[model samples]
Target: MAGRAIVVTSGKGGVGKTTTTANVGTGLALAGRKVVLVDADIGLRNLDVVMGLENRIVYDLVEVIEGHCELRKALIRHKQLDNLYLLPTAQTREKDAVTPEQMRDLVAELREEFDYVLIDSPAGIEHGFRNAIAGATEALIVTTPEVTAVRDADRVIGMLEAYDVKDPGLIINRIRPDMVRRGDMLDIDDVIDILRIDLVGIVPDDQDIIVATNRGEPIVLDQRTRAGQAYQNIARRIEGEEVPFRELAESSFVNRLRRLVGIGNKRRKAN
Candidate 1:
C-alpha cells in the first residue's frame, strides 16, 4: 500500500511548524517506519539543519524535481536513524522554482518507498504554502495559544477546506500552563472553540527545545522533555495507536489554590 503524505503547516510564522515537522518525522522513524522529511520551504530551507544532515546534502528537492539528480541522490539519511531521511530544498531557488504539479508528483513517488512523507511548509498563505500542500493527503496545522496564531490558523483551515483538504488536524504548540491559569493566555478549550478542529497533539513550552535545535538535534530523541514526549505521542497517533494525551504542567499557584479550596486531591484530565 502507498504511504501517507502529511503536510506540516502553519499560516503564521514562528509557531514551531518546522520544529514540529522535524520531531514528528523523527518520532515516526523511531517507531520503525520508513519516513522522509521533505523541506517544501524552497528558498528558506531549515529542515536539513534541524535533522542534523545539512552537511550531507549533496542535492535537494529542486534538483530532484528538475532532474538534476535522482531522488535517492538528493535524500540525506539521518545519522542516528537508518529509516529516517531528509529531502532538503534548494536555498537558491524561489518557491516558483517547483510547481505544484511537480510537488504532487514528487510526493507520489516518495509514497512508494517510505511509509510516511512529512512536508514542512513555509509560513504564509501564498505560493509557497500552495506548493507545500499540493501533494498532501493529510495536514497538521500548528498554532500557538496566542490570539494572532489562532486567528491565522483559522484562516488556513478555511483555505484548506476550499482546496478539498478537509479535516486537517490541529497541533497546539508552546502552551504555558501558568499563563493559562492566570488568564493571561488562551487555554486549550479557548483555542479549540475558535478553530473547531480535531486536536492531534499539545506541546508544552519547553526550553530544551531551543537547546536541542541549536545542537542540530530533534527534541523527540531526548526522551526526557515533555515536548519530545508530545511529539512522540503525535507519531503514535499517526500510526493508528490510541495513545492518551498527557497533562501539561500545572502552576504552583494552582496547587496552592486547590489546597486553599480543599480540593487538592481532585484530578482534571487533559482536553
Candidate 2:
C-alpha cells in the first residue's frame, strides 16, 4: 500500500504541534517505517532544529520548489535512523514562497518513496497552515487542555471540515492529572465533549520534554520519558494498532488503595 500523509497542526501557538510532529516522525521511523518530516513553517522553521538536522540543511523546501535544487538534494537523512529524513524549510523565505499547489506536488513525489510523510504545520489558519494541510491525507490536531487551546482547536477542526480533510484525529498534549483531580483543569472527557473527534493520544506534562527539545533531540529518543512513551503510543495508534490510552492519574498509594477497594466492592456486587 502507498504511504499516508498526515499534517500535525494546531490553531494556537506553543501547543506542541512541532514537538508532536518531531516525536511522531521519530517514533514511526523507529518502527521501521520510512518517514519524511516536512517543515512547512518556511521562514519560522524549527523542525530541523528539533530533529538536530539544522546544520546539514543545504537545500530547503523552497529551493526544491523553485527548481534551484533537486528533491533528493534537499532531503537530509537522520544521523542515527536510516528510515528517517527531513525536508527542512528555508528560514530566508516567507510563507508565500511556496503555494499550496507546489506543496501538493512535493508531497505527491514524497508519497512514492516514503511510508509516511509527516508535515509539521505552523500554527493558525493562515497561508502557511494551508500549504501544510493542502496535500495531507489526514490531520493530527494537537491541543492542550486549556480553554484557549481547546477553543482554537475547535476552530481549526471546523476549518478542516470545511476543507474536507479526512479522519482528523485529536492529540491532547501536556495534560496534568493532579489539576484534573483537583478540578483545576479540563480533563480528557471535557476536551472530548468539545472537540468530538477520534482520540489519538494523551501526553502528560513532563520535564524531560523540555530538556529534549533544548538539546535538539525529540523526546521519543529517550525511552524512559513518559512523554516519549506517549508519542510512541501515538505512532502505534497511527499504524492502526488498538493500543489503550495511558493512565494519567497520580500514582499515590492512597489512589491504589482506593482502586483495590473499588475492585473488591465490584466483585461483591457481581456475586
Candidate 3:
C-alpha cells in the first residue's frame, strides 16, 4: 500500500512549524514506520539543519524534481534511524524552481517506498506554501497560544479546506501553563474554540526544545520533557490510535471547561 503524505504548516512565521515537523517525523520513525521528510521550503531550507543532516545533503529536492539527480541520490538517511530519510530543498533555488505537479509526483513516488512522508512547509500562503501542500494527503497546522498565531492558523485552515486536504489537525505549541493560569496567554480551549479543528497535540514551553534543535536532535528524543511526550502522543494519534490529551500540571479553568462539556475528559474516557 502507498504511504501517507502530511504537510506541516502555519501561515505565520515563528510558530514552531518546522520543529513540530521534525519531532513528529522522528516520533513516527521511532515508532517503526518507514518515513521520509521533505523540506519543501525552497531557498530557505532549515529541515536538513534541524534534522542534523545538512552536511550530508549532496543532492536535494530540486535536483530530484528537476531530474538532475535520481530520487535515491537526493535522499539523505538520518543518522540514527535507518528508516528515516531527508530530502532537503535547494537553498540556492527559488520556490518557483519546482512546480506543484512535480512535487505531487515526487511525493507519490516516495509513497511507494516509505510508510509516511512529512513535508515541512514554509510560513506563508504563497507559492512556497502551495508547493508544500501540493501532494499532502493530510495536514498539520502548528500555532502558538497567541492571537496573531491563532488568526494565521485560521487562515491556513481555510486554505487547507479549500485544497481539500483530509482531516487537518492542530498542534498548539509553546504553551505556558503559568500564563494560561494567569490569563496572560491564549489557552488551548481558546485556540480550539477559534480554530474549531480537531486537536492533535499540545507542546509545553520547554527550553529543552532549544537545546535539542541546537544539537540537531529532535526534542522527542529527550524522553523526559513534556514537549517530547506531547509529540509522541501526536504521532500515535496520527496512526489512528485513540491517545488522550495530556492534562496540564494544574488543570486550568479551560481544562475543567473542556471536561465539563465532554469535549476532552469524557471523550478520552469513552475512547
Query: Please, what is the TM-score per model?
Result: 0.91, 0.91, 0.91
lDDT of 3 by residue, 131-222 (tens): 99999999999999988999999999999889889678999999998988898998999999999999999998878789989999897875
Clashing pairs in 1: none
In angstroms, give how far residue 252 of model 1 lies from its true place. Answer: 10
lDDT of 2 by residue, 128-237 (tens): 99999998989999999999999999999998888889669999999988899899999999999999999999998888788998888888876556777789899999
**lDDT (C-alpha, whole model) for all candidates:** 0.89, 0.89, 0.87
Cα displacement (Å) at residue 233, model 2 = 0.2
Candidate 3 at residue 161, lDDT? 87
In terms of lDDT, model 3 sits at 0.87
**Which whole-number lDDT from 0 to 100 does residue 213 have in model 2?**
85
